[model samples]
Target: MENLKKTLIKAARKAHQVFDELKDRPSSDPIKIESYTGYASQDRMFLKGRVLEDDNIMVTKSYEELKRIFYSFKRFETDEIPGVKVLLYLDDHEFQVYTDEEGFYTLDIATPDSINVKPGEWIRGYAELPDIVGDDGPVRGTIKLRVPDSEASYGVISDIDDTILQTHVTSLFQLKMMFVTLFKEASQRLAMEGMVELYQEMSTTPVGGKNPFFYVSNSPWNIYPMLVEFLKLNELPSGPVLLRDFGFGMLHQNEGYRGHKIETISHIFRAYPDMQFILFGDSGSKDADVYLNLALEFPDQIKTIYIRHLKDTKNARRVANLINQKGEVDAIIIDSTREIAADAREKGYVSEKFVLTEVEADE
Candidate 1:
């Protein structure tokens, strides 16, 4: 009887040890969703975001440029949580989407008659993540989208670097671009002179509602927040800011990179077939090339082209020669916003009373 009692006691001790071990094991880290600024048309609303482990996530917090850059670095290096289920909500509509291998979730919903999205403003929706830390059920991440206003005369499609912000990407080996990107925060970065007012003028229509702006750049999606911050801090008009999603070695750079700008712009054109656009870019990179190609394909939809002149380079020279050659499709190699305002007045894009803020030309 004593031996049996001893065995029972030993089993009880083993059970207690197992319970202690189980109690001490760490719980899984909560998840997070990074939803990007999305856009919609009459029929289709597209949104793209990512699922990631909430631990070790860094956003732009530090005011110090050096610390800020490191924070940006760490933010980009965070791992994506793939194969997660995300529930997307747009008003009374709900959709289920699965993250791809890159932990990116894309919501391409076709709501022809369901969603009554109007233009000239942004609409807000939320994503339901797995759960939050509290008893509040699933965590919610905010998502925003813009649709074109019916009163919009023409939408503005622009490049971010050099065209809007002063990112001198044409410098030898891109030394200046690298320095500005790595050492400077978005607040420290400068936009092109007179561009803010010029773009603001362009963003308004003759009537009440505001015209939309679509910003595209060769910069990767890792700096998406930084660019968005730059736009917001500078008070630049906001729309959908699209950037390269590849080239980090996190995924193959060239996999979907071939004709990326062309493909992206093409998609935009397809989305708003009835609406026309004015294209803006710098001579640097393939902006000129891509814009010209788009003009060729969508002649009726392209209203005009404005390219900011860069330092004398082969591409710049080539664009200069090709500007006047595009027959009836007015492409201007602009030196200042005065020129833009003057021509915009002629094109009826702006009011005749809209005056230029800058008196001097940009050199």
Candidate 2:
């Protein structure tokens, strides 16, 4: 009886320890969908709100639950609305959901039973409501949830002012200030040229049909919405967006960007083992340095590096040399969209068969 009592006590203590560990584990809460309404100046038609999930996970207060619930809200004018498509990504596993109604849809994600997620994980959700009759045909958005024990394949670390949009940050000291003051006027005066073509090219499937366009930007968090709108307007392929927070003490103390882009990229590479990346940036910033370091660190995972030339020819050449030293760049071509496209074609980067074609400005 004494031996049996001792065994029972040991088992009870072990069970309590396990329960305490689970209770203390971190978790994420369901993200609420926000709606909006706007107009596309090109079409001059009313654009209805199509709420989408952001690419990052929405973290909840409870950290140990190991489960996440997400709601997708979509609305259209008529019953014949195109079906809503939802993409849920947890680590390397991706789940797709389709909704037939013009209302709300929900999903429940539970952690894998085998693993006890320690610090929790990030789960991202994306939604698209394309082709609504009597309204603009396209509506797109995304949502995110954080779960326990899950891991992301890759993290997007990006530069904001130029790579994602048309902002010339190097020339303008306070670029975001300039944007806030001039974006509306600029949107009215200047039409986006070649944007659609560039987007189409980037959105197409790669050689092995791998999805490789993740975003990492130097821009601060305050202007994420503006950048997102700009990308959507251009019909560009969207991915995870990482923004720096200027308000953080690091920026004030370091006199440099708050987020160490190279370090972030390195961390992301470690987190997502199966993920490979195509690095995109402009010559206006330290993207060359950051990407060069990344290539050196993760030579196998980095497929190609595309840098937009926003600097003088001499400066651009110097940056090119840095990338060349990295040894992983498949090719480095400097020019606008047309010239880059031509070079890409010549190198068999654009297509399997090299076909010489004229690069025209896309409308």
Candidate 3:
């Protein structure tokens, strides 16, 4: 493992040698909108997207899609385009915002309450940046806004690593994670067994209720587009993905990792104070400790905690102990998503008949 780490570090240094020379260079090309998914809570909308150089080549269909996956890796970040104008248009209203120093912008705007934005539905909207232009004209793209059902029993806040996807966060030195991220395409990575089905069932209500799902990860925003593609490929319920910013400076920083995740999850809780949340994470990293702290802080807001047990028995016991200390919140440590699915069904969180039907169809 130490040798592998050294090799990976050498390769990264080599890549950075080239990256360093180009990092300070500026591009004259117009900026384009690279919008991530957005989610709404109550009367406010939380919007996040990046302003990047308009250098992507258009792709369509099967073969082209494969090429597009490669193009995603080569995407250029226009960090120099900070303070550019970005407009979010919903219905007849337009909310104007500016990109931050990292060329990433987030808009938290007050929107008039409306019943038209149904739960589990993607609200269609256009993001316009008139200064940014492509070959044909001004840079603009369709942005989808996801809203949770008003009658949903509870909302879901999940971690990306190990819970839904096979990221070796718990593996020795995270070698498998490095291997997969370096060589595999989003479609090539495998989803956790029965996770997609279980999530779908949990998100559905008997009266066609649609709960909201949010994915929080330690990964930086650089891979947001690829993660979105992976979620779409696996047919997982889509919601806003909150990711951190990574640059030369972030590499040496560890103080903010836990705090950033806590802040993001707190914002969601504040956004929808009346809505209960189901927390899904793994025992790999600080998830167990983080979730435990969160449940203690917002005991009423959290309905249950689901922690996927990794192979590390010591870590598992530590997490189980932490969960056991929190008597107010119902927490469980399981080796698979199927166990949670069965528990959820038995506890009236989902319909078993619907899950069986969907699984049969997929088979």
Name the top TM-score candidate.
1
Cα lDDT tens digits, model 2, 1-363, are 989966876776666456545544333422222322211111111112222223343221222323322210111111121245544433355555554222233343334443233323233434444332213444445554422112323223345556555565556465654643233322322222443455455445453232334456766433445455665655565544555433212312344533458755765565455556666677767788777777767888776666777657556777777766755455364546555556656644455453324343431
- Tell me the lDDT of candidate 2: 0.46
Candidate 2 off by > 4 Å: 1-142, 145-160, 172-196, 206-212, 249-259, 313-317, 324-328, 331-333, 346-349, 352-363
What's the lDDT for all of these models?
0.77, 0.46, 0.75
lDDT tens digits by residue: candidate 1, 245-329: 5522233345566465787788788888898999988888777778888888999899888997878898888888888687777
Candidate 3 global TM-score: 0.81
Of the candidates numbered 1 and 3, which has the greater TM-score value? 1
The residue pairs found clashing in candidate 3 are none
Sorting all predicted structures by lDDT, with the top scorer first, yields 1, 3, 2
Mind giving the per-residue lDDT tens digits that candidate 3 earns over 1-363? 989966876776667557656765766665678888887755667878887766653322343555755655564343435778988887667778888656777877665675256655677788988777677787897787788787788899999978888887777788998766544567777787788888887887788878889999888777776678889889998888888876533333454565667878987887788889888998887787888788777888988889988776578788878877877678888876667877888888887554432332123
Error of 2 at 50 (Å): 21
Q: Could you say which candidate leads in lDDT?
A: 1
> What is the TM-score of each predicted model, taking all chains together?
0.84, 0.50, 0.81
